[model samples]
Target: MAEGFLRPSNGRMEDEGNKYFNDLLANSFFQYVKRNECEIVTSCKMHDLALQVSKSEALNLEEGSAVDGASHIRHLNLVSRGDDEAALTAVDAKKLRTVFSMVDVLNGPWKFKSLRTLKLRRSDITELPDSICKLRHLRYLDVSDTAIRALPESITKLYHLETLRFTDCKSLEKLPQKVRNLVSLRHLHFDDPKLVPAEVRLLTRLQTLLIFAVGPDHMVEELGCLKELRGALKICKLEQVRDREEAEKAELSGKTMNRLFASLAHKQGTVLSMIFWRVVCAIRQKW
Candidate 1:
């Protein structure tokens, strides 16, 4: 984890981080698994000898007597095997800052006031407690790969949130109408294309919008206002756009978007010709 060691100040710093990873690979500190000619390193395993050394060093650095429980733990990761809800509910991590739950169920009267990041990936949580809105200091919230059908309207009260990720949550149909109130949001990753609100244009600070579906209320031209968007962008339901002039008004060339995909709900050559293909060509050349 290059968290504190690497600060991405520019492109060169990112390259340096990659170079450091490669150096570890070359030294056999990290092993690669190959499929065909492609090699992908999914995880790093510590050698038994190395693990012993690290454990001894950690013990040496320990300054205080062992606590009775995890009451002082600031970061908690709960990986549920089965029926671990009772164990999870018993935790009294009052000073917690980060909580990562890779579980199927999360039952909570959760009251972590200082919590900043909460990740509940692949969880079976159908709904979040209204108490979540009380975490004013929260910044990163991820509820991806879950069965949550809807978010409580009180979620709009998190004014300090910077990243809100709900990718692959197929059951989620819509976002709160007042989602525009999250003025600090910089990244919003969602699955349902139609869930995007017409007021998305007000999120001028947004940078990573995964998908945008053009509809009667949210026109293609609304994308033009998101000048800060970069990386990949998928524009679905292109059949709704009237003509090429309207598509061009999205101003794809003005931003730093590298990968662009445009899809039509229905195959209409005239609409595709006027809006879709031309936009793709413009993006291909711009990047």
Candidate 2:
């Protein structure tokens, strides 16, 4: 997806992408697939037999070492394998594009103006420099399982960003307010659905939103506006909904998803018994 290899010209990109992926899996190109409760593949590993054929395409660098030659290098994988610190010493970065890092980048900033993908999953990093706006071509960023608490507001400047995943970052508070400015955004995966920005409905191209929490500032209809949404979605704070008319506006019945979960456990007198009953019936009728 980061390379636009599965991008489709029509319909939802994820739908077409998943079809191609299943084809590859059925053909024995992928192995050890892991699926979620919704039966969606979450992770997978390539067969070692297939790895040998593509070994030359991937270069393995030693820990705490300086880069020697970097004329045609585009991808760098520094996912921590041990306690050694990964150093970016003597590296001549000119046009590097991708970086998968799990260790603290030391020795230098290792900033490459042409960098495209940056995955810092399971790292000790805390914050991103506001200077990240310089990566105009950046398309993918995954900071899952990290200590990062906040993202620089300048990240909204990357108009080309399509995927921004920060899942499992327990300390993170919320997404940038100007996130809607990322016109090309297609996916926003986070751990806390309540932390999602209120203006996220503006991202019309969005396809995957696993959870949503209705609040005073957000309406239930916001999820309905995202026509491309798919996969599993859990809607929390269903008691916040006012009436059946409002719930009808959510159009949950027409949503093309695998499973739907609604939680009204916190219901209070705030929702009248008669109104709430009609509202539940309205939504269920659609489903």
lDDT per residue as tens, model 2, 1-287: 66667767786666788898888889788988999877778899777776676443343456644545534556667645543233344334545567777765522456677677877889778988787788888889888999888988899999989888888988998777898898888777886865777587888888778778888767888977887777777777777788888988877677777787777655567436567677767766745
How accurate locally, in lDDT, is each candidate?
Answer: 0.70, 0.74
List candidate 1 segments past 4 Å from native. Answer: 1-68, 81-92, 103-107, 269-275, 282-285
Q: Tens digits of per-residue lDDT for model 1 on 172-230?
A: 88888888888878788887787786589998878878899888778878888988777
Task: Write down the worst ten-residue block by lDDT for model 2.
Answer: 83-92
> CA shift at 122, candidate 1, in angstroms?
1.2
Among all candidates shown, the one with the greatest TM-score: 2
